[model samples]
Target chain A: MSKISRRRFMQISGSLVAAGAIPGAGLLTKSSFAAEPIKLGLLHSLTGTIAIAEAALVEAEKMAIDEINAAGGVLGRMIDPVVADGASDWPTFAEKTKQLLQRDKVAAIVGCYTSASRKAVLPVLKQSKGLLYYPTYYEGQEEDKHVIYTSQEATQSVISAIEWMAKQQGKTFFLVGSDYIYPRTCNKIAKPTVARLGGKVVGEEYAPLGHTEFSSIINKIKAAKPDWIYSTVVGGSNVAFYKQLKAAGLDGGKQKLLSTVVSENEIDGIGKENAVGYYACMGYFQSIKSPENEKFVKAIKAKYGQDRVVGDPMECAYNSVYLWKMAVEKAKSFDVDKVTAASSGIEFSAPEGKVTVHKTNHHVSKKVRIGRARADGQFDIVHESGVIEPNPFPKL
Target chain B: MTFRRGNQAPRRKAVIPAAISIEETFVTFGIFVMQLFNGLSLFTILLLMALGLAIVFGLMGVINMAHGEIMAMGAYTTYLTASFIEHHLPGLMGVYLFIAILLAFAVTFAFGYVLERGFIRWFYHRPLDTLLATWGLSLILQQTYRSVFGAQEVSVPLTTWLSGAWEPTETIQLPLNRIFIVALTILVTLGVWYILHKTRWGLRARAVTQNRAMSSAVGIDTNRVDALIFALGSGLAGIAGSVFTMVGSTNPGTGQLYIVDSFIVVVFGGVASLLGTAASSFLIAQMQTALEYLMSGSMAKVAILLLVITVLYFRPNGLFASKVRA
Candidate 1:
């Protein structure tokens, strides 16, 4: 009814027209075309090392965008996706975010997998007062105004993973990870989390990303004789980690290991024989048997083919886009300022089930699932929490 | 490059696993033996990668950072062959490794030739510039590979021989894939050595490496040899990439992990000397592998690199520079 709202609607509609969402501009001049789609940017490593899992997230985001658009678009306008690859480089991720915001002028961005990368672009997003929807479970120890973390935080992921290991597996845990901000921070948190869970961390070690040898680490684990190996090793390093574990006769069912990041995507590298019986903690698994999840899995397979597998990170990515759409609709506009204010407490039925945005912390209410790797590179969900509010910055 | 630091053997002794009892000595030795085998396995893979990089750096005086991308080309080739075998011939994925090796070589050789003629030819003798340019080219190639192959690593399913572990002792077992890479490395190294020394093409290649201007003056097609040698080098890297899949994952950026060590091998082994490259590959592999067995992977990598730096301090031109010279 107000002039500003009328003009804001027209401006958003004009963008849809420019992006080819509308066939003709004839309706723009008309008095009554109230329906205009919101524009959201999706950025992730589509071609880099993290692509192993990030690719699935990209596809899921696309699928969600298509579904949302088919359902008459978010806020009565088609959801326009501006996709950019981080190329798995930290600086490049920061640069691409600037490009997406300044050049494409997207309202919000959903991107990043690694914490280093998020740290790289955090200042840029914060300074620009832009919203970034990060979808990976991470070693969270920060509270930022510009980012909405739609996945598990450090306390949630590590604490839950440790609780399961302590109760079901063992009290003594050997920790392994690639040396980076996330792994280091995760271990830092694990120290206390393990203590709190009545568990003891027997050994802690780190390897560089893409590292392929694990003999020394295996030997340490063997010597320590821990109840289980709690691994946070990421990327290509994990292949060698699991392989060497198997080669050293320490694979699942023999020498138990519970991984926080290991999922169907990494299992494809570790293979079924090596991954079977290994436990992992995450929010999504291919084995989650819900109607919504079944539809999610079916749609992914239908679009990407039957052999394609979906994982926790992908589901979070999918949910982030939809959550953004929900925020836009609730706000009744695509303006960044309005959406930022409106995003609080916005709820969307994600494949993981109902997720609500934590307005204060910029994290979502996420459930935790502890799954065991089966013989098919798929997971068997063994334990789960009802719903834990996202704890982005756990009290230290 | 064989990084023979004076402190190496002593440091290696420090790595001997602490055995609590006389009975545990056998287990310790078994672990040591497995570490040795692991070193050899890694050596084979690294040798395959470094051989091509050595030739390109030694002969062309260009850094060839895209060497990893060339190897990636081979990896994708292997992926394609595996897919074909899986779909068309079923149960032939094992046999397909041979075909994949050849395909990887052919694709990367042609790619290398094009890269030299189209881009690298102009950037000769400029290591830093070549480094930046080839890095840019690496990005392009990486993007191209990702767009074509999709972002996820396409698993090149190994044959029955390549899968599983060979357990000799209860504690010490050999991964068959590691064994395969080591064996393949030996075969490839011998094959390359034979071509480089025993063949006419190899003679011409050596002549150019010795003195390009003089070789060109003496009725040798030095320019053509440069292109072919570069292509062959790239093809070698491609083979290395193909073999690498047995031990590691092959993604778009997988080539990066090898590039740094490959450079260290080329430079440390007397850039132009294939034998030097081979020896350095083994030594570096042994040191890094032994250290990894003794220390964490990160610390081992740092230790190995420091050893290389120390070696370069003693032998600035590398371990066997004279052999590669006149």
Candidate 2:
């Protein structure tokens, strides 16, 4: 309330400014004490058709961030996540990726569940020279310098699954899928693999995405009487397909069915009773017996509640964060080029055992496990392959 | 497209052998019969969905874009009811499906009644406004469902009685769920026919639809009739949703999948003619099911859309236009 002379006020204000600036300047000079949190963008569909699956990826990424921060932080800087919903729309994914990279200036992004969403964001990432750690098993033949694919490609998943199924079961196969780029491409890989393994594909069919009427397909399967059914159907359609299969009395006991896409999340939706005994091949399963997986599962359950199921994508998403951390540390900076260069041979003791980044393709090498679904909506690991190098482009 | 080729190559290779052998001919016959049943079931569902739209769009001239969301509400209702039965009355789980269907209809009926009074009434004559408004309502309702029930797809437990199929031959199997859906559709269609032709409300509704001024002058409360008709249409959609749970998982976005198909069914059929709705749905469903066997599902879908567009281009009034008092 008291008024002072202008010179006196100016002198006091200047000293106060200097007093604040000195400590701030000192703190800024310390390399580890920048005080600004390193932000990582998480672009996922939190609402829409894909939300059922992508929401879990977001949670897994957050859990990884929390665990990394708890373990003395990443490079002595706390990890901050910038989450944005793509709304299950492809263009929205591109827009959000740009916003995250350009506006939020996140060090790296871990996102995109669907291949379409990933494809949409790829151009933006390429333009911005940003790094994206994509974590979904997809059709192969794509390799990008700006992206690190943490999950399996078609060769590692669908082809491996087909080879294993043909060896284990009979050679004859029936292929069914949802009408989309991923399923169609996976089936394209599956057909030649089945043929190469001396197996004849009895029937192959595709239903439109979100198509619930699988009665005709089931009937076709019945007539064809294939030794095994390989389905790449995804999303809500999976629930209907499995349920209709069960209702038609064609279950695991009557006929063997294997999938590259079905996991704990899908089994949860299709109901355990319907999905039980079906085999799914993926890089990780929740029931993997490794101590690393045990701790990962425990931490996730503790954070997200016991009812939340962790599937391949979620585990891959978790692995991506740690992989990014390892790369950043190896590069000693968050620069995209440096991190990408340092990413080769970067290893993370993932929940699925050890996963190493391939030297050239920016894809990871990991073990593939075939798991049989249990009544509790968890997988029982049936077969595990030793670490297989990723093949982004495989000759048919 | 490569996958489509992959699918077709095997099919074509298989077909040559199928065409050559008499034994394969029997197998082909069995498959054809099974596909017929499949097409019938699809037709049944499409008919049920289009019935409500036929009444609302055909009779009331209101484009209820939220019709699918109303169906989703019914599906969620069944899911909740089944979950409740599972948790609280496991002993009655087998018999709970009937009760769930009834509850689905009633809940959606009341919801439609409220929706009519609150929002849809204002945009009665403005078709485009009603469409936009109902679409906005659908988004709101979808978000509401997501918030209330979570975005995850939920499935209703199948009763033990409905859990398996009826196999008449070694090669042919009929799913009990599809049969039940077909029967339910028939019963509902009959009931709807009886209501529209034999009841006082039907006569009033028909009069109002045909000549609104004359019906009003004759002391009929057109507003009340509109609400009842809308609610009835919504209730039918709820029934369709309840039946849908037998075949598919229910999610917040489940309704969107059916909206366009149902609209196609209603508009392709004459909007006001129930018979036209049934025939068109049957034709569309059968053609789609048959074409899907010959080509990729997307290509089949493209074919169906083109067919529908061509048909509409020729007959904008629909397959069977009813003459109303002008």
Candidate 3:
């Protein structure tokens, strides 16, 4: 080492301090910002109609953050989360995304439940050069560079479900969903897939969101007498749909109805007895028989309370945090571009088993599952499609 | 809640079956009959929901924004009752609903009494103030319910007797729960009518609304009458909430979904005419059921709401506006 005067050493240290290499605190936040907490934004509807589902998602994400901080955090820095309320409004999602990106300047955002909210946030994410780890299984029509979809896309979920139904069940499907962009788009793809698989889509209907009446649709379904009914009804309306379906004598044992939306959380709301005999497809289930999943469920319940149950999106929301942490570690920096680059082809040991970030599409490759809802408010895993690749724009 | 993959193609992992058996029959006639039945089903439920709002708004002249919350209280009460029965009276599972209904009424009745005494009574005669104040009360009640019974919806298990459908023919199936709701709606509607028209309490309620100071001078105990009428209205709403659990949800904001529709029903039926309320709900329900059968759910809803607006424009006093002294 070369000998240096005390005055010269002080000057170098002063310049380093001024440059913020050592942060504002003397020796606390050091290692070129490694010691400082990396701020991550968590956006979800904490209030309003969507809050019943989205609020729990926020809890799942926070649980991940708490777990990450408890263990050694990514890049040797504690993760600090900036929570934003989307308030179940699309414009609010855009506003919050802008605030999270431009104001708080979070390294990455993990949020949004509805596809509308995701679409609202997309433009803002791209413009701000921010990353969003969206956890919802949505109608995929884009491969955005600024978004990393942590859940399955249409091909990984809806197509796989329709294929299974066509093969094992009947050839006819009555496609139904809550009238929204996601449901309409899903049905659009589903109709083609059913045709491609040499199955007939007997009838298709879109009930308005929050619609509680389904008797007329059930009447149509009965008239159509399709082998399977593919439903995409979401939110509080699900309770009415399931209850009415059961009351109409079309139950799990007879009428083969499978929903892409209802999960353990929803089944809990729809009542186990009401959902019994129906089917749901997802990337994860609380009953997934895996040591990793068992641990995840146990740990989540231990923290969130045993009364609380985990669902596919909740698991994916939890996975988004870990996936982002892995990306940050792989890049060895929190730079947006670097994280995006390192995120490609990243593999995570999620509760849903091994989930991989697609090399190019920015979506994940995960297992697709179809489970029959049992009376115990849990799914009985009936079928599993081996890890399926994500395609944001599937050629029809 | 639902997702799809974007552009690109991949072979499905499953092997395609060479042939699939699909039934080609669609029972169009049976569907027509079912659509009419669905309208009746909707009418019964809507009437049950609107009955309480009609009474409260017609007699009190108070626009209660928290009416939904009061109903949610009933739903939560029913849920609590079901849980209790499941744990303690497992054998009574089949009839827990009846017990739950009575308990929901009593609980919400007490709650309504206190609410009117502490909160609503102060805002009497100031309709707009009641609207704003009750709106805040509704929010507070929602948060309170959220704290008490987590934010998640609490579902009440339907009894076996109420779970099945009565199928006269393979295609013509009527839900047992809806039938049950219909029977209950008729009984409650009649009971409410009897009380309002044939009872002394109803006369006092009517007198106070007609002339509060005059009724007070005539020794009606106008304040007590106001509290009782409001409590009775709340109890009815509670019953509506209990009935709603069979077909709808039970959450903190469960009240919100029905609030707008409830107001629409009351307004479209003249302000103080119960018969008008019943008639309007019937018309609205039948229209929705028919439109839904003929078109998309969204379009049906738009058409129904548009009809209500158009009618309101033509008859600002609603379909059965009274010619009584103003």
Candidate 4:
């Protein structure tokens, strides 16, 4: 038997031996590798600014979990999903992650919306030796042994977006972003890439995170007359920025905006009327028209109801749980070490074509899709960077 | 006489040509037109946010830091209503905004009433304690909202009339939402004015605000007026929040950003006088908006705060304080 199977057998057999003193002692087996339900923990920001995005992830995860459970569960045993709310607080994410890892003793935990929240929970997950499936388009410096990044890496998402903008629009790029580590790092990567790609960084400005006014920034953009705006601004601020941009008469056909973070979900706040015609770069758009994507979309709609909106992060999160299931089944054990070891180079058919887990850095190979906001709060996929390789650790 | 005045204007204009310079003319004209509209719009949102806070703080003197949370509740109400309209009543999304905004006011008003009765009523006189208590309450409300709503932003859909730019000009394209907010503020202010100046409840409320013992002796149920005022204020805040959904995102922690500004407006407006509140709101909004044009938003905020402090330092009771208070 393998070392993991041996450890599992010992652990199971030890627990069974302890339970052998109970009424079911007769049915108790000596083997530790006996059929056991795998318990996975789900932590999410259920009640804060991130909650709107985070709730969809939880729903997607549940849908995936249900599908896996319906298919006789992973490794012939049922899957138990233990959910905990992060409450949108950074410290709460860490606290809840600890509860999931220590108290619940889940096999693997899938959670986190923001980089800050993910960072807060990283040490807890590491110390407890828990596997984490982080689904976010984050600044890709972090390469944790325990994390399996199911979303697009920051460099791939942002770089591909800039390249696409340069080719489609002219080569003048203006960087606009919310003043946060993610946006700052994203802008940092974008500025150099713009220079390398023979483009000019006209005017780079930072708005306070959750800032609403964009008149000044918009005026600066109009004055600078950049070909396309490269925006990394996130959250509630986007609503104000997009509205103000439209209000200030610099919208759609007049001036093209290429945002790294704005997605179908953001369109809800920005209103379709204001957001229509703005280009946003993300891995997943709602309008992907593949048979696999259709089925995935159909399934999600059916599970969450037709009125529910799906975004890139939600799709990645849905894929993450199923990907974990595939990894667990391939390894044929609940042991984190064995599961992780088997996960590397593992391929799973996702909504975004075939996604393969890069063993070295743990990020999945993803397609880069640039979509424009439609009139009805949905995205129209304008460009797709087919099967881009996951480069989690860049030579920078 | 008209021709003489016009002809004299040319001779006088030549004598003091510096006063009629193109740049100075534009500047003055810009300030005059923009500041008037700016004052009106600022008063609209300010009144919406402060009307409820004024009652809560003005009557009970309970420094409710969670008033912003109440506004968030209203914004979420509008979001949910928009969702409902999109789902079940697609044709009524425009009309739904009105219903949703009104519903937000009612719901938050009820919520504020319950909150006042449950916990806030006990700590009426303890301003510092109430401040801490309400701050804690605000945190709890924010967390509860996050737990319920999730972390992602849920946008409230606006009708074509309430979305996008209003003006044809590229230089001065005011958003339709801002227009709607301005209109809503006027209607709300009028409603508040009617309640405070014209109604029997207003008399009792004002009497209680002036001196609680005197109002009670005059057979006015001060307690009832306090509760009603609190609800009215919360409802106004709800309307403000609902209107804000046109321009802002609805989130659990979104309230944190506005509460400080709401308090500043109410305090700077003078605690008791509604007219004082209106004046201060205009001053602050105009200062912030105009200064934002001159400097960065963060720097402008600091400048406005400094201006408020300087003004308040000279006139301790605020710019339009009551003669008795001064």
- Candidate 3 per-residue lDDT, tens place, A1-396, comes to 988989999999899778885445656545465567889999998877778888888888998999999998878889999999998899999999999999998999999988889889989988999999999888899788999999888777899999999888569999999988888888988999999999998899999878888988888788778999999998888899988988888878888999998999998899988888888999999999889899899988899788888999999999999999999999988999999999999999998899999999899999989999887889999999988998889888
Summed backbone clashes in each candidate are: 6, 0, 19, 19
In model 2, the runs with Cα more than 4 Å from the true position are A1-34, B1-26
Q: Model 4 over residues B1-326: C-alpha lDDT tens digits?
A: 68879878878867788766776565455444444454456556666778777667755666888899998899888888888889999988768988998899889989888887888878877788888998999889887776676665666666766656665433345557677887877778888889899998887777788888877998988777877878888888888888887666677777876888888887887777778788888787767666665665567778988988988898877776764321
Badly placed stretches (over 4 Å) of model 4 are A1-25, A30-33, A329-332, A392-396, B1-44, B76-119, B132-153, B168-170, B190-203, B290-326
Best by DockQ: 2
**Chain B alone, TM-score, model 2:** 0.93
* Winner by lDDT between candidate 4 and candidate 1: 1
| lDDT for residue A159 in candidate 2, whole number 0-100 | 71
For model 1, the stretches where C-alpha displacement exceeds 4 angstroms are A1-33, A47-52, A99-105, A269-274, A329-338, B1-19, B113-133, B323-326
Q: All candidates' lDDT scores?
A: 0.81, 0.90, 0.88, 0.80
Check candidate 2 and list the clashing pairs. none
Q: What is the TM-score of each candidate against the true structure?
A: 0.87, 0.93, 0.90, 0.83
In candidate 3, clashing pairs total 19
Off by over 4 Å in 3: A1-34, A102-104, B1-32, B169-171
